[model samples]
Target: MIESKRRRRTVANIATYFVLAGLSMFCIGPMIWMLLTSLKYEADIVTQTMQYIPRRVTFDNYVAIWTQSGFPRLIGNSITVTFLTVTICVATGTLAAYAFSRFAFRGRTQLMLGYLVVRMFPAVMMIIPLYVVMRGVGLVDSRFGLALAYTSFLLPLFVWMLKGFFDSAPRELESAARIDGSTRLGAMVRIVMPLARNGLVASSVFIAIAAWNEFLFALMLTTGQGSRTWPVGLQLMVGEFQLPWGVLAAGGILSILPVVVLFAIVQRTMVQGLTAGAIKG
Candidate 1:
């Protein structure tokens, strides 16, 4: 009886593994298709029946995209805006989170609620007003302006997420640091910040992804290649009559690579940060 039960349990485990593997493949199948499509020749892409595997995989699509599409400029603009936005979000969010988590001042709860409300406000509603304000401030068509706008929009989310992580941190560590000789700011920098690395990483990833993919604001605010991001550049590939599928696919794959690498690097920290808040709460 014991032997039979053990065998049954082992079979169940095998079945579970197969199910999970299948699901993972299903999720990743489109991405695999995109990569394959990006490498296929333009003629092969328009064939009668879709071929899962490319008959003749060529680097021409990538090369064409690089040489003809001005992807380098788009990539540079994306990196600049994403990096700047992430920096601002992380810096300001950490400070705001620390304040919200560590202190109890007048109207603190109300202020936090207000921030949440601002986050919920539709981007569409604010776009016109934001454009007008940006024009008034002479910020239109500037990378700095776009970064500032993204930072403001993303900061509230970072604050909410980081605040949860900070609240989960042990208060004793800060108290002990204070008792030893550290000021509040010093303790935060030396003790609290180190403990919240996971949270910071997680917040940075979120902010980077958002800023990198932002299109609506970038489209309306910026006019030329100087400020145009990858999304905007990709949209430019769609002409009046025809769209270059291969080039578009190549551009998408390239655009997604950095974010994928980033997530792979910080995935562990992101998971820990996300779950730590839930467990602590």
Candidate 2:
């Protein structure tokens, strides 16, 4: 009877794995198809027949698009805007989150909720006002301006996320550090932060992803390639009457590579951070 039960459990586990594997394939299938399409020849892409793989693969698409579309400038612009946004969000969010987690002030909770309301407003709704404001400030078509916009939208999220981790941390650590002559800020920076690295890393990843992929704000704010991002560059690849599917596919794959690599590299830390925070909470 025990052996029979164990065999049944094994079969159940196998079925679960099968289901999970199938789901994963379903989700990843489109991304896989894009990569395959990128490697295909133009003829393969334009063909009526569904071709999963290329008859003749070429590196020419990647090479041609890189310079033709001002991709290097776009990449630089994206990296700059993303990192700047992350920096502003992390620096400002960490302090605010630490304040919210560690201190008490009247209306603090209400203010925190207010920040969420800002995010609740669809970004598209904010575009017209944001455009007018940006125009007034002479920030249109500027990368720094775009970075500031992203930081505003992303900061509240970062603050709330970091606050969770901070809340999960022990207050005694800060108290002990203070008794040992460390300032409150020092305690937070030196002791509490090290313990909260997992959360910080995860939050940073989120900020990077959001900033990198943001399109609407970028589109409204940036008119020239001087400040255009990969998403915009990818969009412009489509012409009035002719769309180059192979080039578009190649661009999509290239665009996602950095975020994918970063996620893969730090996924373990993010998981640990989230799980540890959950347990503590």
Per-candidate total of colliding backbone pairs: 0, 0
Model 1 alpha-carbon drift over 4 Å, by segment: 1-26, 270-281
Question: lDDT per residue, candidate 2, 163-240, as tens digits?
Answer: 999998888878889999999999999988888888898899999999999999998899998899888878887899
Question: All candidates: CA RMSD in angstroms?
Answer: 3.8, 3.1
Off by over 4 Å in 2: 1-19, 271-281
Model 1 gets an lDDT of 0.88
**Model 1, residue pairs in steric clash:** none
Question: Cα RMSD for candidate 1?
Answer: 3.8
* Per-model CA lDDT versus the true structure: 0.88, 0.88
lDDT of predicted model 2: 0.88
> Candidate 2, TM-score vs. the true structure?
0.91
Clashes of 2: 0
Error of 2 at 47 (Å): 1.3
